[model samples]
Each structure stands twice: as structure tokens, then as C-alpha cells.
Target: MTVALAISGLQKTYANGFRALKGIDLEVRQGDFFALLGPNGAGKSTVIRILCSLTAKTAGSVRIFGADIDRNFPLAKSFIGVAPQEFNASLFETPMQVVLNQAGYYGIRRPVAAARAEEDFARLGLWDKRNEQCRTLSGGMKRRLMIARALVHRPRILILDEPTAGLDVELRRLMWRFMTDINRRGTTLILTTHYLEEAESLCRSIAIIHRGELVVNTATRELLGRVDLETLVLELAAPLDQLPPSRFRLRRVDATTLEVDVRRETLLNAVFAELEQSAIRVIGMRNKTSRLESLFMGLVQGNEDSTRAAAAALSAAAGD
Candidate 1:
């Protein structure tokens, strides 16, 4: 498959000498839902701003659908649509007008834009509120309106920056379904969200950045598999006064439940053997897979540890 968005050696430095992005490189395949995860001030937003032409980059290049963002700004921008972190619609304008106005900015004709806006609003469950001023809509409704605005132009790539933030669970799930439908229809999506589970479920690939540097970029499954540990949840028949001395280390999650992190070589039978010897009957057991949260924390914290280790090594060498 062809690359939908390609970024190479992307760097962005602010006037205050803060390096927001340090030569980040990423390739998003067409028709793929790509999630970019990071803590606040991690440069995820900087990348999105640069891709959508909202902010200028200090160095490097961005290409959307083979058209350079800087050189072929119009053509490249035409292929991209962005829904920013903050809602920027005119509060006084109706939902239909908000979308239609956005479509017009992309050079769509008024009549066609109006028709498309109506269709998108209805599909997203905002048709009934089309004539209501955006300020009159609830938070969830506003979020749906923003999504409709972004889709009015029907760009090939959609960049969503925390699209479901502040939304209720039901609304968030609805938005997820909407995004999946859009992706299934061959629209490439780039999502930046705090919800790790959402990223794990919606994105095929993930890229994590921290403190202005790219940390990890790989297939979501590949990244999760890097942990090399399985979480075993074992429910004991009764509360344990104390844990047994087993080959595998166990963590007491609750009175009756214990969480054991076991290596791949350690079989489930071995765990059962230990429990059986302790006279603890296992009522139920389940394995929890390594999630994005664990993988992300491990990478970022691991980098910190490595940096401290390097500093200590230098100190020791100097003492010699």
C-alpha cells in the first residue's frame, strides 16, 4: 500500500529555545488508523499542526499523498483535514452553517457544501440540531459538530486531536464507531488521544513521542509484544493470610485475587502446582495482555533510567 503521510527529520523549535520536536520520522500507510500517543507537551500536537499547515516547522519535510506540504501547500493541504484539540467553530452559527462555512474554505461551492453538510450532520446524529446555534448544543453535540465540519471537505486524510475529549462514554463509543466507519471507507486517520484503550482498539500502528523526541514507532501488536511478560489473574478459594514461596513471584491484587507476572518459559501448570501445594484452590484464572499503558510507561521510564546510568558511568570513569 502507498504511504498516505510521510514525515522525515521533522524538527520544530520555539522562539524561547524550546525544541518542541527533535527530528521525528513517521510513515502512515493509506487506509490505516494511526494513533500517536504521548503525555502533554510531548510534541504530538506540534506534529499535527505542522501536517495541517497551522504551524511552521524549523526543519525537515512533510509529504501528504506525495505532495510536499511546503512546496505544494495547496495540493497537499487539499488531501488533509484537521479537527483540532479545541473546538473553533463560531458559537453563533448553526451546525449546518458551521460545516458549510468550513467546506467553503476548502473551495467547495455553497450549494454542494450545504447538501454535504446536511448529509454529514444527519449521519453523525446532529441533523436535528442543524439549525440550532452551536452555543446551544451540549458538549457531546459540539464534538459531533466538529467532526462533521472536518468531513465536509471529504479529504483523503483526517487528523483528529483528542476528538472525544470531555465526551460521555456513550458519545465516545459512538465517535469510535464513526471513526471506524470512515477508516473502513479508505480514509487514512491520524489520532492523538489520552485514552490508551482507544488507541489499542482503533489503531493498527502507534508512535509514541516524549519530551520532544521520538521514542517508539511500530505496529501496535509488535509494541505490546515487546514487554515479554504475561499477567495471570488467579482467584483463590479463600483469602490468603500470606503468599506462598513459589517459583514465580506473585502480587496480591486483593484478598482473593493474585496477579503474577510470569515469563514466557514459565507454564501455567507450574503456577497451578505452586498453588496446589499451598492448598489454595483456584476458582478461576485469566491472562491479561500487556496494554499500551504499560508499554508506554516502560519506554519513557526506561529512557530516564538509561540516562541516569550513563551519567553515573561517566562519574565513575572520571574518579579513576
Candidate 2:
């Protein structure tokens, strides 16, 4: 597969002597829905800025679809459309004007830009709001407008930084659907977001940076599988004063709720059988956290030593 984006030995240091990125290396394949994730101040945004040419790298190479940023910056940048974390559209301009001007930046003709703008606006549910001043639009509307602007130029790769931030659940799902369709239509997507579930559901592959260091990069499913433990939250049918004994690690969340840690080797039926023997009836059950979210918490909480090894092992196994 062709690499849609590539970074090698990437380093960045602020003027104040703060290292923002440390020898980072990553790649996203063409047509891939890839997630670049990290906690705040973990260099996720730094990496994106470097790719979008908004920030200069201290040392290292970045390539967009084989075009080196240093050797052919315009070509590299031409292939990228970025919806930044912050709303950057001219608040004084109408949505149509904002999108059209973005297209103009890419040298798209006015007629072509207008057609694309209309299409993108309709798809993002902003067609009616296109004539409204951006400053008058709601936060979610502005977010969608940014996405519409990003699409107007028809770039090969789209980099979304917290695209769904501040969006309600319904709007977020709508945006997810739109983004998923974009990827399905062959647009490579690189997403950075605080919402782990967004990445877990949408990304085919993921890379995590922690404190300026690349810690985990692997297929999302493979990453989740590495989690040896899962917490099952069970709501009991009846409240109990005392806990029931079981071989599985269990903790009481409340008189009517229980949290049990189940290992990969353990089966749900076995857990149910044990609970039955203890006369604990579970009225409802769900995972305490998404598998990917659980793994993310562990990795970002200074437990990345083992995970870095796992990422290396996966990379080697894939012959990367």
C-alpha cells in the first residue's frame, strides 16, 4: 500500500527549551482511517502542525504521499486539507465565503469551488446556514462548517484535530458518518481527538504519543487484543449487604452493583455460573470502559514501557 503520510526521526523544541516532540516516527497508508492519539501536551498537535506546515520541525523528515515537505512543500501541502482543533474561519465571513476562500487558497476555480461548496454544505447539513455569518452560527455549526471547508478543495488526505469537540452525541455521530463515508470513498483520514471512543470506532489503525515519545502504533483491533483484562460492570437484581465469593477479581461498586475483572482466559459463562452459585443475580451488564479506552488510559498513565515493546513487536511482525 502507498503511504499517505510519513514521519521519521521527527523532533521539535520550542524556543523556551521545551522539547515538544522526540524522535517521532509514524506512517499512515493510503485510504486509511488512522488515529494519532495522546493526552494533552503529548505532541499530538505538534505532529499535526508539522505535517500541515503550520510549524517547523527541529529535525527530521516529513512526506505527504511521497512528496517530501522540504523538497516540494507545495505539492506535499496541496494533498492535505486540515480542520484544525480551533475554529479558524473568519467570523465576519459567511460560511459560503469561508469555504470558497479556502478553495481559492488551493487555486481551485471559483465555479468549481462553488459547486464543491454546495455539495459539501449539503452533506454536512450546513446548506441552509451557508449564507449566515460564521460568528452567528452555533458551535456545532461552526465545527461542521470547518469540515465542509476542509472538503471543498478535495484534498487526498484530511487531517481532523478534535473535529467533534463540543458536538452533542447526535451531531458527533452525524459527523462520524460523514467522515466514515469520506474514508470509504478513498480519502485518507488522520484524526486526533480526546474522545477515545471516536478513534476506537472510526480508525483502522492507531498511533499513540506520550510526553513527546512515540509509544504505541498498531492496528486498533490488535491494540485492543493486547489488553489482558476487562472490567465487567454488573447491576444486581437484588441489593446485598455482603459480597459473594468468586475466583474472579470482584469489587463492589455499591449494594446493587459489582465490578469484576475478567481475564482473557476467562469466559463469561464461567463468571455467570460462579455468580449463580453465589446467588447473585445480574439484572444488567456492560463493559466498564471500551477496550481501547482502557488500554489508552494505561498507556498514558506512565505504563507505556510494556506497550512500547508491544508496538515494536507488532511493527516487526508486519515487516514494517
Candidate 3:
């Protein structure tokens, strides 16, 4: 597969001397659904900004489909489309105008831009609202409008930053379907979201950034396999006086709930059998957290711990 996007030794520092990205390297294959995730203040946004040519990198190289951003930014940008985290369309402009103007930025002619705008509006379920002012649309509609605007020029690679934020469940799923369809049609997608389930379910590969560094990059399933233990929340049919002994670690949540830690090697049937032997009836059960979420937290926390330890050692050395 062709590499759609590439970054090597990427570094970014702000005017205030804040190092937002610390020499990170990453790649996404053409037509692949990729997830770039990090907590607030991490370098995910910096990377996105650099790729979109919205911000200059302090050092390092970036290429979009083999076109270098520094040497051939217009060519590189021609292949990219970005739907940013915040709403950016003119409040007074109609959705159609907002999308058409975005197309115009890429030098798309008015007739062609209008046709593409109409197609995107219908695809995003905004056909009827296309003539209305952007400020009048609901939050979810505004999000969809931004996505439609990004697609107006028909860029091959789409970078979505928190695309589903502030959306209802139904609308979020609808957006997911639209994104999946585009990816399936050979458009590469890059997504950043705090929704672990969305990343785990939609992205083929994942990269996590922590404290301005690339922490991990691998297949979603491979990252998820790192989780050795899964917690299950069980709703009991009856209140318990005390907890029953079992091979799996179990903790009481309330009079009628139990939290059980089941290792990957243990079968869920074993848990049910143990509970049955103790006459504990589970009326309902679900995972305490998504497996990917558990692994992500562990990686981020471990990175933080290492950073703190290294800083402490440096401080002690200075004192010595």
C-alpha cells in the first residue's frame, strides 16, 4: 500500500517556548482508517496543524502522498482536507455558501463547486438546511456542515479532529457510517477523538501521543491485546451479606452489585460457574470499560510516570 501521509523527526515549539511536539515520526497508509489520539496539551493537534499547513513546524519533514510540505506545500495540501475541532464557518453565511467558498479556495469553479456542494449536502443530510444560516443549525448539524465543507474539494485524505463531538448518539453513528463509506471507497481517513470506542471500532491502526512524543503505534487489535485483565460489572439479583470466594478477583460495589476482574486466560463461563456455585445470581452484566480505553490509560500513565522519574533524576543530578 502507498503511504498517504508521513512525518519524520517532527518538532514544534511555540513563541512562548512551549515544546508542543518532540521529534515524533508517524505514517498512515493510503486508504487506511487511522487514529491519532492523545490527551489535552499533547502534540496530536500540532501534528494535524503541521500537516494541514496551518502552522509551521520547528524542524522535521512532512509529506502528503510523497509531496513534501516544505518544498511543495500546495501539492501536499491539494491532497488533504481537514475538519477541525472547532466550528469555523461564517455565522451569517448559509451552509451552501460556506461549503462553496471552501471549494473556491482550492480554485474550484463556481459551477463545479455548486454541484459538489449539493452532493455533499445531500450526503451529510443537510440538503434541506443548506440555504439556512450556519448559526441557525444545531450543533450536530454544524458538525456535519464542516465535514461537508471539507469534502467539497474531494481531497483524497480527510483529517477529522473530534468530528463527532457534541453529537447525539444517532447523529454520531450516522456520521460514522458516512466516514466509513468514504474510507471504503478508497479515501484515507485520519481521526482524533476522545471516544475510545469510536477509535477502537472505526480505525484499523492507532498511534498514541503523550507529552509531545509518539508513545505507541500499532494495529488496533494488537494494542488491545495488551490488556490482560478485564473488569465486569455485574448486577446481582439479590443483596449480599458478604462476598463469595472465587479464583477471579471480586469486589463488592454495593449491596447488589459486584465488580469482577477476569484475566484474559479465564473463560467467562468460569465466572458464571463460580457465581452459580455461590448462589449469586447476576441479573445483568457489562464490561467496566472498553479494552482499548484500559490500554490507552495504562500507556499514557506509564509514560507520565517515566517522564516524572527522569525529571526527578535530572534534578537530583543538578543538586549533586
Q: Top model by TM-score, which number?
A: 2
lDDT (tens digit, per residue) of candidate 1 on 32-130: 899998767788889998888788999999999999998999999889888888778899999988888788788899998998888888778898999
TM-score of each: 0.86, 0.87, 0.85
96-189 per-residue lDDT for model 2 (tens digits)? 9998888888889999999999999899999899999999999898888878888887999999988887888899989899999999999999
What CA RMSD would you report for each candidate? 5.5, 3.4, 5.7
Residue pairs with colliding backbones in model 2 are none
Model 2 residue runs over 4 Å out of place are 238-245, 250-257, 290-295, 298-320
Rank by lDDT (best first) = 2, 3, 1
Q: How high is the lDDT of residue 172 in model 3? A: 90
Q: Give per-candidate clash totals.
A: 0, 0, 0
Colliding residue pairs in candidate 3: none
For residue 163, model 1's alpha carbon misses the true position, in angstroms, by 1.0
